[model samples]
Target: MSHIVSIQTEIRDPVAIRSACDRLRLPEPVFGEVKLFSSSATGWAVQLPEWRYPVVCVVNAAKLAFDNFGGRWGDPKQLDRFQQIYAVQKATMEARKRGHSVIEQPLEDGSIKLTVNVGGAA
Candidate 1:
């Protein structure tokens, strides 16, 4: 049996998403850019940035898993994880589309900092 693993990324801009995809050497059309906001004790906002092509990050990952693991990723749990990661990637991309720079470092805090700046600086 083959095992497949995909690293998570935080990017909220279409441009940034494209750059990341290139950096990761992943295929195109990772996802769409859209702002998602949820209100709670700690209000949180999420965004999924648009891609240059007609590709969804989630879908690409599924394909990659199948290619790497020989269909083992068909398992429901694996699919769920793929979807969750994809959602996060999309949200990150959206944030970048809104002119917010997302910087994620290895730390306990799951929060990512968005630096708003004029012009593109990714």
Candidate 2:
């Protein structure tokens, strides 16, 4: 009795999606055109373990939409994983792009300490 669920999100970058998948140790994401509500959009497909269908990620003008998905083979935890991995990847990319250094430390509490800076060299 599981049905498709469309989970809206703040994710828009295809590169970030790819990075997220990499963090999960899953297969590379598939990217191309997708059908949106009233039109078609192009983005990537997010695939988690045991999911028969992938969530369609469509980006338009820097906005991302996660189309309705997750019928029977979907785990709600996958969305959490995507957010976590995407954040790390996006943070690292932005920091480096700003000519800064990034350091990620995994805490004993299972959280990550992400530090970014120019190390006062600026």
Candidate 3:
């Protein structure tokens, strides 16, 4: 069995989001941060910081999705998500190094999630 998680916040500044994404690119894939933007019924947006390529990221995102919408645990799905995030994070880093921007669109169901900055010299 698996667990579900939900992420909720209210901060949507395009500049801030872009800056955060840029800063996140400085780290390695295992410790890159990803921001999730969510909106309430009234169109209010929230920014959520998450780890982009970690097992915890996938598990947490699924938890949030499941919490919002009732669902059963699917480990395979979660693992697939982890892989996707990792690949994306790696690609994002490479793109950023080449002076490109990373834009991750939000999901309609409000399950948007990402990774946190890590993999720094620790």
Candidate 4:
């Protein structure tokens, strides 16, 4: 049996955030109040490659706050990629905690496919 899931991502786990950053080879996220372009946010801040401001993940609120200045300060694709990887890492971790195994594949369309095996069985 198989299932398909579409996730509306909310960055809520700091451990998963660190995992995603490590997977992407980006900087480790820092927890504190971070300065944006004209405002400030408090959370785990992840700085993407070539981005001017960091993306702040308020875990308790499951929200992200950032200032890209309308794509001038950062490429939205980078942020999207981070979110995608974060979702994968988070899901894989949860599945493993429940004694399940995961297989991941990268698709041609820049998307990842994850298959979870129940009870560690293929």
Query: Which candidate's TM-score is highest?
Result: 4
Stretches of candidate 4 exceeding 4 Å from the true structure? none
lDDT of 2 by residue, 24-95 (tens): 888888887755445565677676776655666664555544534544456767766677677778777877
Clashes of 2: 1
When 1 and 2 are scored with TM-score, the better candidate is: 2
Q: What is residue 13's positional error in candidate 1, in angstroms?
A: 14
lDDT (Cα, tens digit) per residue for candidate 1, span 2-120: 23334354323455444544444445433434222221121111222322112233333332211213333234443343344444466556667787565444335533333433344
**Model 1 score (lDDT):** 0.38
Give the poorly placed runs of model 3, Cα more than 4 Å off.
1-74, 109-122
lDDT string for model 4 (1-122, tens) is: 77888888889999999999999999899999999989999999999999999999999999999999989999999999999999999999999999999999999999999999999996
Ranking 1 against 3 by lDDT, winner: 1
lDDT of 3 by residue, 19-117 (tens): 433444422222234333232122112122332222222222222211112122233454334334444555455556666555555577634343322
Cα misplacement distance, residue 53 of candidate 1 (Å):
24
Of candidates 4 and 1, the better by TM-score: 4
Assess the local accuracy of residue 44 in candidate 1 as a C-alpha lDDT between 0 and 100: 14
| TM-score of every prediction relative to native | 0.29, 0.68, 0.29, 0.97
Alpha-carbon local distance difference test for all models: 0.38, 0.67, 0.34, 0.96
